[model samples]
Target: MQEPTLLILTALADEPRHGYGLIQEIEAISAGRYRMRTGTLYGALDRLLSQQLIAVEREEVVDGRARRFYTLTGQGRAALAAEAERLRSVAAEAERRLHVLRPGLQGGAA
Candidate 1:
């Protein structure tokens, strides 16, 4: 999964979130590295929800607006962990290659 997607998953790992809350959490978690426009955020949410990786837990009204709260399913947790492991594996391999190529210290910078 892409980092943005993984980041959404990570944010939800903390708690269930509605659309706007999820958006804010992802941005915060990324240290402002990621900021999703509504279009892209909803697209990713739809895909994950359809896959049963995330589910609508409930709905609430705030300021007369209905908001759907989403939570990670067990499958979602597993998926997030698998994605993280995959990234870690690839990162480790890349660093190893960097060590061989450049032999310098940015934790084996290439």
Candidate 2:
């Protein structure tokens, strides 16, 4: 899965969020490394909705504006779990290789 998609799923894993909330959550999750544009976020949300990975948990009108909150589906939870495991495995292997290459090195940076 793409990084943005992964982040979105992760953000929704804990609780439902509206589009703007998702944008903030994603930015915080990435430690400010990624700033998602509104258009991009909505597009991804639509795609995930179609894929059945996410669903609209609720909709409300606040200050005359409609807000749709999204939550992760069972499939989305499973997918995110799998992706996290895969990433962990890859990182572990990279760490092991790094150790072999530099016996005294404990991590990636010097």
Candidate 3:
């Protein structure tokens, strides 16, 4: 839906990740722009799972505490690809506009 939400879906697109792992991945992927709280993370997870975009792939205990891993569904993959494409398109347009306006926005590329 939004950037953080889209980022969450993108992170989960690569592989199954537990809640905490998903948070870490998103933070890393976005270079720390998206820091997800447990409440917000779980809320998004529930919505995605309910929409059949993601599924609980497995549950296990590492040190006596249970954790669940979630994997993206086919629908999730398509959505992620579409979202990525959209973001890329936006970035490309931004770069084109910057080229017209500043003419050195790329920092030594031109």
Structural similarity to truth (TM-score) of each candidate: 0.79, 0.87, 0.84
lDDT of 1 at 56: 95
Judge candidate 1 against the unseen true structure and give its global Cα lDDT, from 0 to 1.
0.89
The root-mean-square deviation over C-alpha atoms between each candidate and the true structure, in angstroms, is: 4.0, 3.4, 4.1
Which 10 consecutive positions of candidate 3 have the poorest summed lDDT?
101-110
Model 2 lDDT tens row, 70-104? 99999999999999999999999999976685555
Q: lDDT score, residue 58, model 3?
A: 95
Q: Which candidate leads the pack in lDDT?
A: 2
Clashing pairs in 3: none
Better of 1 and 3 by TM-score: 3
Worst 10 residues of 2 by lDDT: 101-110
Give Cα-based local distance difference scores for all models.
0.89, 0.94, 0.87
Model 2 residue 103 lDDT score: 52
After superposing candidate 2, which stretches have Cα over 4 Å from the reference? 101-110
Scanning candidate 1 in windows of ten residues, the lowest lDDT window is 101-110
lDDT of 3 by residue, 9-69 (tens): 8888778999999999989998987788999999999988899989999999978878999
Q: List the residue pairs that clash in candidate 2.
A: none
Task: List clash counts for every candidate, in order.
Answer: 0, 0, 0
